[model samples]
Target chain A: MAKMTLDQLRKLREEKKGDMVRREVEGKEIQIIVGMGTCGIAAGAKEAFDAIVQTVDENGIASSVVIRQTGCMGLCHVEPTVEVVMPGMPATIYGRVDAEVARQIVRRHVVEKNLVENHIYDRPAVDIVKK
Target chain B: MHFSVSDFLLDLVQNSIEAGARTVTVRVVEDRGLIEASVGDDGKGMDEAVKAKAMDPFWTDGEKHARRRVGLGIPFLVHALRQAGGDWELESAPGSGTLWRFSFPADGVDTPPLGDMAGLALSAMAFDGDYELVMERRAPARGTEWTVRRSELRDAVGELTDAGSLTLARAFLESQEEPLDGIE
Candidate 1:
């Protein structure tokens, strides 16, 4: 459990910095944001979030996929919601997501570019405010 | 209610941050079939009455968030640890800091898995605020003890939540985990 040497840490930092630069230049970055507010945590969003991260890592897609944790999205009923944003694509919000669904999202929605129809929760916006 | 050890830890760390802690320290140690964890924070500590209520799943201070009616973080951890033949204690005094210490049988059949600590550490950094987080992992069997500080990480990179910084932090945190053979 001894800490890594300063040289090792420096090298790792440099590697990560290089990776970030490479990903940015590729312009194919995907961001996966997981709601982790109190409601989300009570509903087990942590597991789903971790599952997605592990899936992305296991598939060696870390260079292209970025996972982030965020506060509530005002959808308490859909506690463990995950929002995915891909380059040149509309952001997709998935509801009632579990660990298994998280994996599916990465595989189908992210990799294959096919939205998982059943999990999509966002609806078309309506103009309700008076002009 | 359902969470891995890492999840539990992240929740607890968030709790400390919400308590207005300027500094938080988390330590996990495995020794002789026992796994011990402690989180200490220099936050707005609780008195006896508040401490008692904090242990109740149905009780919440109502100051943090108005929408939520219950605080299950402490209670849930207590439940899991006790179910696994472990015990926990909390020490706090108003105007002082708080410390939570818990231990469980490492090999217990009901003990939850350690899960992903790297993710936990990264998430802790995502928390809103400028508080410091110190994490240490010790495995006597392997004669290894690794320690890290949030400030040091920030100094190394720019921000922990940045993509590149997060990647580096995750790698560093994961590297501290004890080998499978060292857990027992």
Candidate 2:
């Protein structure tokens, strides 16, 4: 019933190789992490996650940014959280990120090089785990 | 509590990921009136005693979340299934893996509507790790079925985290699921 099949995917792959100039995800500059744990999903992280993806895709910055889904960040009170790590910019964690907030996050914090200060939940140490 | 079955699937699959599963399989069979779903993972599983303990609402071992003080996933799942006139099956053991199966009346008063399948697939694929997810959906009444394999997707699209690929992936999943699913 679907239009995009295995063949379509392969075709897209080939076409993308020719047309799309994508950067390697391994050493990306910006990394966006969305909490996908039970609590987060219950609070509608699924929609937020999709919205972030859609926004980033629309903005055409899929090359430099890598979107990731993480389990939990220990912020149960504010489920559906989004953490942005731009490597050089100060990392930020926004709480209660709905679809709209998720889009704003990608547009403001990630694309425009600013932070969503009001919704800031917590700023992690960037390295909670010892290397 | 999980508002929709999609969230339930995500929660349990995340459990599998946390348990160290290298491969995970998810199946959903939906007819006009019934919805049956299952998720099996090759992750470290719980024994009989541990499984029983995990079902307790007051139990907390940081198994699912570091800040999750109470056991809400399984307990609420059982509670929701019962309220929806559904039953469940779970198979697991120490050193083995875990499999969860359940079905509910789609028209039940307590049943939640389907969530966005495209989002579910994209979210699962977005996890940062080396794991494979095989998602299968079937609608016998409509005689339609579709399956997405992680390895195949990876081969087609280098990394799912890329926004361009994710967009394409979401479009593909939505197209496949549009005819088979209900309200989100």
- Could you say which candidate leads in DockQ? 2
Model 1's alpha-carbon lDDT is 0.75
Per-chain TM-score, chain A, candidate 1: 0.75
> Would you estimate the TM-scores of all the predictions?
0.75, 0.89
Listed for each candidate, the true contacts retained, as a fraction, are 0.16, 0.63
Deviation of model 1 at B180, angstroms: 10
DockQ of each model against the real complex?
Answer: 0.22, 0.48
Q: Which residue pairs show collisions in model 1? A: A1-B144
How well does candidate 1 score on lDDT at residue B56?
92
Q: Best candidate per lDDT, number? A: 2
Per-residue accuracy of model 1 over B1-184 as CA lDDT, tens digit each: 6467766777777778878999999888889888888889999999999989988988888664444456677888888988999988899998789998888798999998876666667677766568899988777886657787888877776564444556566767776664644455
Quality class of the docking in candidate 2, CAPRI style: acceptable
Query: Which runs in model 2 stand beyond 4 Å of their true positions?
Result: A17-19, A22-28, A123-131, B63-68, B180-184
**Candidate 2 structure lDDT:** 0.80
lDDT tens readout by residue for model 1, A82-108: 999997667999988999999999888
